[model samples]
Target: MAADAAPRSLSGKVLDVLDAFSADAPELTLSDISRRTGLSLSTTHRIVRELSEWGALERQGRGPYRIGLRLFEVASLAPRGPQLREVALPYLEDLYEATHENVQLAVREGLELVFLERITGRDAVRVLTRVGGRFSLHATGVGLALLAFAPPEVQEQVLSGSLERWTERTITDQGQLRRMLADVRRTGVAISDRQVTMDALSVAAPVVGPDDCVVAALSLVVHADGASPHTLAPAVRTAARGISRALGSPTARRHPAGARRRASGP
Candidate 1:
């Protein structure tokens, strides 16, 4: 227990403290940071003060601690991270204007789906998703789309076991999920009906890069009542294609109707 309580190195301690903040718990107290990092209060406070001084964490007037702008300034330099968001924002705007629904963009990281962007209307069905949040790859439209085109090893690894069930409609059966992925590959789109939430439905399509590899996905979320997945697919796919074009994908403009490529899109 004593061994487990100690970080192996100074770098590990710094990293553990930095990771204590999350989308769900953006602001944390010193005690919260201590518990999250499994470090003693004195150690946690010492590092927290150092990090705060360096602008990696922020504290205001005895307020809870939150991640600081300096991290964002550094993170902005990542090529495919926020830079991709800048390219996709205009297409996302167009999709939102056309449908007035919840539009989202996401990328696959391991077996988790990380939301990159989201645009929601006043009446969009309520969702638990937030930008920079992560969810499983078997319970969302963007998840299915990215999973469908993911490397075979990643597919097999996720399918092997531990498929989580988010809602009653979420697919936990490996065989069934395999077939759904096949359908996504066949149609160039993915539909998630009440998979994440019973009141919402999502339609998604992939955005491929110039190398003909899928890089991200785009989707639209609407009320499930009287909703049509096929009806929404075209617009969602169109937005995905547009974002791909803005990212300089050669196949974006050249994609044929019902393209047979892995990432046919719109």
Candidate 2:
């Protein structure tokens, strides 16, 4: 007979409850939480009561419960999330003012990329991403930029794994993706032309931290009809470099004297 499995700890059970909430299912009843977390109704009720009391979950008129603002409060303390966004917002705003397109900032989390922020004009081409949402690392321009500078082992894992296709233009073949990542590194830019949606394209560049390692990616998503990734590359790269400098990246800070003037614009 197989050995019995180890029992889950109280903290693990609590994590299971929190993990039950996601973008698709933002609200859930006690019974729903119990079912999703594989916890007994009594346990679920006890935990939910405690979490609600502690402000981690909030109920709506005896109906389903949703994630609470307390969670966002705690998440704001994360150096890589809110802090990074705070540092990059100015440069991002400048990019927005220049192009009036969909501007996005993202960071790689394991094999996935999580959006930290997005700025879009009312008339900008509609995009499917939302701040704090997670996406695969092989589809979006920001994802590609993050993936290109990822550690070799991380790169190998993504290249060896199955790539998801969001649209007909999404790259799925391992060899092709490998080549694409190489190009992103060589050119210091990544382009996703209708990869996520048939009507949108994005041009992205890497943002590095003080360690001189990429910490995030910045991108501009626009309507594909008249989009030119080349035309947008210079501005995107310049903004990314500015963000890196603001973050104190040594590589960005050490540019030769006149390089800064040239990088400003033509």
Candidate 3:
């Protein structure tokens, strides 16, 4: 076995300073940063100055600081994030137009699904989720689709955690979520009916990568009464297969064994 790598040393104060900024606290004063980071005022100031000079942080008009453009530029280079989104957007837009519903594209990060893009139809059902927002892997349709195809360790970790409930239909039980994931894998699609919102339903399918790993999920959320999950499954599956093909997934190059077997059955 290879030897374990040594941990790299970095000042706690520097990490603390960086951790102070969040999606909610995108901009903060030096005093606010110091309090949030639990660092001394002088140390916070020093590190903030260093980060600002290095283009990782930006000092705004008055005293607040925000993540800088340089960080955004660097983050855009991430292949699994923006790069994947760029390749999938056109296909997602097509699905949205066809269904006239809310279209979402997301990827799994740890046990959460991070929304990369969303397009809302003119008369689409309203949802609480937003772009760049993170959600649990056991709740939303995209989350379920991603969780279904994830590595076994990831599934175990999610099943072992505290599964929070969002609505009456949410799957808070580990056994139920496990069953749902198994069903998703078997059917090639996931359906979350009023799991996240009471009035909406989501249908999702996995987007596989060239390595046969699920890299993302594409979903359409529509009014629960307007469309049946069964009716939407085929469309979502087709779009997902198209995206997987574009990504060079070997599985997408051939029909699924079940389908092939069905075609050959007497």
Top of the candidates by lDDT: 2
**For model 1, how does the per-residue alpha-carbon lDDT over 138-235 read when each residue is reduced to its tens digit?**
88999999999999999999888698887799999999999999999999899999988899999999998778799999999999999999988888
TM-score of model 2 (CA atoms): 0.93
Backbone clash pairs for candidate 3 read: none
> lDDT for model 1, on a 0 to 1 scale?
0.88
Range of the 10 consecutive residues with the lowest summed lDDT in candidate 1: 1-10
Q: What is the clash tally of candidate 3? A: 0
Query: What lDDT would each prediction earn against the true structure?
Result: 0.88, 0.91, 0.85
Q: Can you rank all candidates by lDDT, best first?
A: 2, 1, 3
Which structure is stronger by TM-score: 1 or 2?
2
Q: After superposition, how far is residue 112 of candidate 3 from its true place, in Å?
A: 1.2
For model 3, the superposed segments whose C-alpha errors exceed 4 Å read 1-12, 255-266
Model 1 stretches astray by more than 4 angstroms: 1-7, 256-266
Clashing pairs in 1: none
lDDT (tens digit, per residue) of candidate 2 on 91-210:
999999999999999999999999999999899999989999999999899999999999999999998898888899999999999999999999999999999999999999999899
Q: Quote the lDDT for 168 in model 1.
A: 94
